[model samples]
Target: MGKNDFLTPKAIANRIKAKGLQKLRWYCQMCQKQCRDENGFKCHCMSESHQRQMEVFGQNPNRIIDGYSEEFEQNFLELMKRSHRFSRVAATVVYNEFINDRHHVHMNSTQWATLTEFVKYLGRTGKCKVEETPKGWFITYIDRDSETLFKERQKNKRIKADLAEEEKQEREIRKQIERAEQLLPPEQNRESEVEDSAARELKLESGVKVGFALGNSAKLASKEKTEAAKLVFEEPESDRGMKRKADGGGSKSALEELMREEEKKKEKINRKDYWLCEGIVVKVMSKALAEKGYYKQKGVVRKVIEKYVGEIEMLDSKHVLRIDQQELETVIPQIGSLVRIVNGAYRGSNARLLAVDTDKFCAKVQIEKGVYDGRVLKAVEYEDICKIVQ
Candidate 1:
């Protein structure tokens, strides 16, 4: 058919409308043209321009595909690295952000069929840290920039250097303290010698200077005389030496005889004092126990005996300890008891006691704050709370 003969206004209008909505399926990538219909696309396929473009593409189609694939991968990784550097987010989230740009490389045109496959490729290639969670697959982009790696290494080196400096200073201070302690003994001896000399000078000024000097000489002579008297009256030097030799021979005999007598005496005392058992180490309750004097001077209790009675000394309050009692009475917080917080963020606020921990001496309370109700606070120490109402 002739062109004008087939181009009726009504026919032309219908063709134009079809062209407006017709899918541009057969497109020439190199020639950059779209045909309106199948017949038109077939005609264009036979055209010289389309044929030339096909010849160029046919020469090395793999190279063109590879270039496009590389571009797609580069654009995707850039988006992921910029948007979700540290976060382990879903691949779809990053893809959606990437597609927001109209010029962004489409995934369907790329080698990866799905986002999950692309993420898996990135993980396999060590481009990202990928993991599958209950929610979905997530990924963190790996930064391969040389400058960033250098900065991280520098930061770690500085931290290690600071630690080394601190350790060196600590060692120096320890050495100074040890040197100071070593000097203390000589310093104390010098002070003692000065004090003795001062005392001798004070005695000389008390009108006994010459007399004290002579008396000291005489005391020294008397000490020597006493030593001589001991040698003459107690035993002759030769006899004393001989006696020491004989005593050495009888040393084992003397020790055995002494041990027998001591055992007999110990048996007699053990019977009389056997009923006197030691007391146990218990929490004291009296004012005397609170004093530093009592802590410094009192001997420790070693045992708790039957029918043993002693006062509990807790600072000022005192309670008598009855050893015969089966159970010791202790104060315990009751449920629903009102208590005042003595410390912490909720100090001065009142709460209802919910539970008591006897072993820890603590309580769980429902704390009320402002319009908020019933906050469960755990392990509030007994000392940190006061019973307001039972």
Candidate 2:
């Protein structure tokens, strides 16, 4: 037939049959050629180029098969690693994805006779986690990359470290519980008597007791005054609204006299005998006047009133709160010292120290900026204080 005639229907049918993988078994591995049929394959074997290729392959047939097997395995594993690195996939499912690449090495040319055999080989070599399910064989890529191994090792190490830290904390807690139990025996009687105000009392890590007798006495005195119908003075205003200015003055004097008498009674208690220092923190007890919002406020002791009562500067520094010693808790940080907060929402925040209860290790801090900036003070722990260099 003429070259133009080869494009006819009969000739086209012949050409179509010669292409594609219809006769996979008859394909040449060394020459990388396929034939149309048995006759065509016989003719291809007789060709000069085919003879030269076959002659070279014949020198070491096993070498050629080994090369093909290696190529096939490498390409298959690369596909599995890239496409299904994190999934457990069926063998057939992976095979389907692998064949999508037209240039992929065919299994027939390799040593593995079937996909099952290749999967078994992969499992045996520990390249993949393999399992036989009811449906079929499933495979998951075994991540053996150096980076992946390192990350896994790091994760395990962190988990182990966390477990160890937790165990240490538990051990510390057990020790604390034992110590508390031992101390409880000696203080049980005193603790029962003090139980009523225990909730109001702040305990410091350091064992220093703020005097309570003065606070209780002040409470009793205040209670007696309330029962006696003592006239409470109103805020000083213009005489225009006063029924009698003289009456107001007389009432004020009476109030002063009553206070002086109370002071005299407290003086017998000897205030200076308990503490040797000033600027210690104390809680303003319940008996303190609530109108100034100092009933439960924190203040630095400017002076001790009658051994138990304290004349203190409130957190604002603008007001003073005078209360019995029981209301005050000694805070952690010392006054006029610089300290950094270590716990709570303001952790890592730096502030100037205003007052401290050395017994309790609790401090009142004055923060000028940030979330803690306000007229009111923040109470924090001595442990939370980060020491400043200068």
Candidate 3:
């Protein structure tokens, strides 16, 4: 019944006027009030309640502003997560939506003077990925909660572990190389020590042989020279040693050379960042496929398209499907089973699985027949080696 009563028509009209967002300049942050115009804001500033709030703020301006800044940031990010968590939305669009809440924190009370500044702060703090295009600033939310951080930490740990294992394997290979080099001299000197010294020491004593003869000396000396010449020319032991070294050095087969060239090509292909290969058994890991009865089912890769998508024939169902490499997991075979190196240094080569380190998700494989024959890859990832379709 009263003019200023809550249920009066005048009070309803005021509420309706305040229902929508008002200009920031006419808002009184100290009293948490939004005025309709500059005159109203001026009048509110002159009021007792606003003056009291201003005095409190004046006592610790920095702390008050910082508190408001934190609250604004929290509310803004909360809205972003709830609405645009996985989208690239314009900053202005998000800001407009945020200000729709009647009781939302105002930007004038925060550290940033403008929305652009706030968005830039979000980028600098790594809260969102911000990019400026012709339309204005666009932002994508970056989830950094406990679960995301835990997953990222696990990924980094796996990477570091793999790098450490690779280094260990390289050191072991280097030691093997040193041991091999040390064993070579022994092979070249397998003959008797006296014979090796006589043969290895090819130079003659003082580069000449002294001979003295009495009567009939010329014929005897000539005969002696002929026998010495025969002995020098027929050096069977030294000749055999040289021939063995030559054979060992040239023992690389043509097949081995071809594999070496293929490895070089693979090294170049690795840069293309493609990993799919044909004739390998892989497990489908797609949640979408689960509804179609294909999730976790094994398949044989018949052909690879665009170096990423594969045409796979399901082993059990005999149905063909095209799937991205991301939805496929490599199938690890039993020890002694032949596997193809689908990634890493010896990619495209067939290797025999020697051992598996389940803890590290890596395997020790010996290259079966190639330039790296008998060479052991000590820490190939499970995904980098796969079983052939059988």
Candidate 4:
């Protein structure tokens, strides 16, 4: 009907020409035009519309280029997130898929000279995990979405609960210790110390091995006779009640046994049967998998199936495996990470890691939850704690 109508040959041809990707060098970023050939691009540069755009770009070349660069980066990453999320993909592969849009901001207009440089930039800024292999560069997206943040906050909430619990335990322990101290008063302690010093304390120099001689029977009998002459069953200057109080049925020692019994009771009650939580790193301990060579390998807990089962995604191989929690041991992260005490007097308690002793294969941690918060365990072995995957 009309010369430039949608049905017209000219209009159809224009659509066909713009259907797929063209040479990037022939595209003008400022004019937002794609020329089919060098001759067409050269001619378009001489046109009035092109001349106007060039003049505008000339006014602030750096600002215009920067704007294009930012847009390009944003669009590229958006495509990456939408398409290759949770997968390791080659830089060129993603770039190839990106160019199929026909209207993507060309790399020529961006600050980066090549795709490799752009991939390296992503790695440096920690936006993506980048690696260069013999095959070329590959990237995996790092998720820092609100969902992840929500999980971390939930984890922090759990830690706070742990801190409160630990604090209570500490208070109880302190109270018991105080009660024991009260039972053993200063005066009784001094008397016990004096008696102990007389019996056991020796003012011997270091490395001096003193020996005693065995005299004849006659001298031993004479010494025994003198000791028997001084033997008396009479009470001391103190009253009989005080004497009875001095040896009062292992008073301090009995209190210590009471404390130990209380701790054992706590250990039985607080130690949970379920320690499997979502989003934690754990090791495969099932001997059944040893045949498949997965034993002792680490994985991330994607989901907790039941209280005792987890859907784990292996770290090295990226394979998802359904494993029982009993067959999985939790992993320990770096210092300052929240860890659960798997076994110990503090079993099933959550704690914050304080320091590591690599040579001893042990870690120092402070209990962070229920009754033990602020209590520091200085030499917990590596096997006794596993990191919380927040």
Candidate 5:
């Protein structure tokens, strides 16, 4: 049949059926209408009300598109906020859930071209937290519903308050129990004999006749005096000197000498002629001379000596280089040395070294910005340095 001939009953019906969305594809955002079949949708589209709506849309196409976009954004955000708020979820998961609603606004109609763009937009607008990683972008919906967030906060506060009150009550109960224990008779008796004696004396003065055993008291006093006298007389002066002489024997003297020699050896082991400075390596002259084992080479390596500042002296089969005290100050980068900042919040700011204050443990750097040239910074450790340009 010709194209005009296809406008007949069966042909038109089939074309309408093919052009219409399936039952699953039907969506309605406002009245939330979803028609399963082509006939129903075609009937609705031909109705007077649907034509009136189309006329309104035709008046301002951009406004209708914007309205749909806004509706779509709102619905999607509501779903995310309610379901996955405060949780890092894949953008696709959220999008899939959003599309489950028939009549949901299509993402193609929105301003964002992709999910990543939408997530970034949300982050920029402070509507959600978005983080980008090697795997993919993650998003956590920001819940701005005041009542819900306030209720959650109130619940947490109440829990904290209850815990604090419970702890306080526990502490109070513990104190009460401790006070009751302190007041118990057996514990009081174990405290002091003087307190018991005082109580006894008070009872006696109150006309209560309590008999005291004087014989036992006299025996205890006599025994204490005897022990004191023994302690005062037992130590003799002559025995102390003899004990000292016995302890200071020939073997003990030898052991002391050996200890002194060991201490000297430790001191020799600890002593090093060359020391490493910051970012500078120290190489020993003896290591260079020791190439021919016992033959004892003499001359200092001029190439190695040029790298360091020192006076080389050949002393008793060894080359000794005395590093100048000024060399420590000289090797360090002076003011105006070009350097880069490698770490911390102010990273990537290139500047000239203003000063090095070892006492303060800081390096003063001067950074120029346009015509101002006023910014300065203090860097403190190795992590703060990138490299010395010069």
Candidate 6:
């Protein structure tokens, strides 16, 4: 029939069927051709071209099979990598997809006799993760890109190194703490008793009368003084009440006390006024202020940063600054100025502040008395404490 006549529906269907893979027995690997039926294959085998190709194959039959085997493996793996790189699919299912192409390498021409043999070979070579279920063998592609492998290895190494470093630091800190605890005499651990007795005798001998003479209150006042000394000094405005008390001829000691109070308030305010702002000039306020004397060694604030505590940079030097809003603004606490634990198992205890966890609304405290006496850190809820000492 003419080419145009062959375009009919029945003829088109027949042509498509013919182009599809036929029986394996009808395909010739040596000739690299496929025949539609037994009669055609037999007729082609007898032809001069087929006879010449057959003679060539006879000279090196194994060589021809080896080439076909390599080609089949390369093509099969390429398809698997491209189409199902991240999928865990059945071997039989992949084989079916592989055969959808009309000109795909036939398994009959490859060294492997079946798809199962090829899949087992892939698993043995570590090309895929293979597991057999009752239904069939499933394959998961293993990415072999060298760059990706290197990056993953490096990432794991860094993570492991960081964890090791943290563990080492924790061990060292624990050792130091244990050594310090061991060096202390048992009697010296009674922090509350020591502070009360020592402070009361000093006050009495000096003829100084405080607001409270009770041992507990005395101990608390001593701790508050220590905390105030450690905190960044911000000067407060001189109180008129203190001035009036001094004018009333309160005592020679009272005039000195009023002056000390005024000094404390001034120190507090001065520290807060140093908040960092870009391009704003700052003076060096360090230990050198005593030795080298205060100089106008001004530098602009480069950046403001917040770690566990706030920090600021002027020129190349970084300085720790007040981070707490109340402390920064000099706002007084409504709960009073003493640090006391009011709840939990350690209720009625007092401590010095080490750090505050603003997010957790808790304070890390050093226990001064009770079972946890001499303990440097105990986490207590902010609500359970009267106020942070520092």
- Cα lDDT listed for each candidate: 0.51, 0.58, 0.73, 0.70, 0.50, 0.55
Q: Positional deviation of 386 in candidate 3, in angstroms?
A: 36
Residue pairs clashing in model 3 are none
* lDDT (C-alpha) at residue 293 in model 6: 39
lDDT of 2 by residue, 1-390 (tens): 676597788789877775444556777767777676788889999999999998898899888889999998888888888989999999999888877664667777788898887876675455776676679989888777889879968976975575455446545644654454445444653664565433122122332111122235444445542222211221224432352454553333333354345434433322222331254555554532567576666666676543444567776554865444434444443466665554443444567777776677577666545522422234566655544434
RMSD of each: 32.9, 29.2, 21.8, 17.8, 29.2, 25.3
Q: Which stretches of candidate 1 lie over 4 Å from their true place?
A: 1-51, 144-147, 160-390
Write one digit per residue (lDDT tens) for candidate 5, span 228-340: 22211122345445645866521323323443454354334333333222222122333222564422323232222322233333334455444321122212355766555
Tell me the tens digit of each residue's lDDT in model 4 across 296-379: 999988887535557888889999987766568867798888988876567767888878999998998877646545556778
Candidate 1 weakest lDDT stretch, 10 residues: 204-213
List TM-scores for all candidates, in order: 0.32, 0.41, 0.47, 0.46, 0.31, 0.42
Model 5 stretches astray by more than 4 angstroms:
1-32, 35-48, 101-117, 131-137, 142-390
Q: Candidate 1 lDDT, tens digit per residue, 1-390?
A: 565565777678766765533333544445655556788888998999888878887898888767767887898888877777777788778877876664555554456667777776675455776666678778777777889879868975975575455446545644653454444466654654555322111111111111111123434455542232121112234644564586663233332344345434433422221121232222322232345434222221233332222223323333333221111122224687666664443444567777888898888877654321444566777655655422
- Model 2 segments beyond 4 Å from truth? 1-6, 173-390
What tens-digit string does per-residue lDDT give for candidate 6 at 292-336?
A: 433333333344432111232323344433221111111113322
Clashes of 4: 16
What TM-score quantifies how close candidate 4 is to the native fold? 0.46
The count of backbone overlaps in candidate 6 is: 12
Selected candidate, larger TM-score, 5 vs 6: 6
- Model 3 TM-score on a 0 to 1 scale: 0.47
| Cα RMSD for predicted model 6 | 25.3
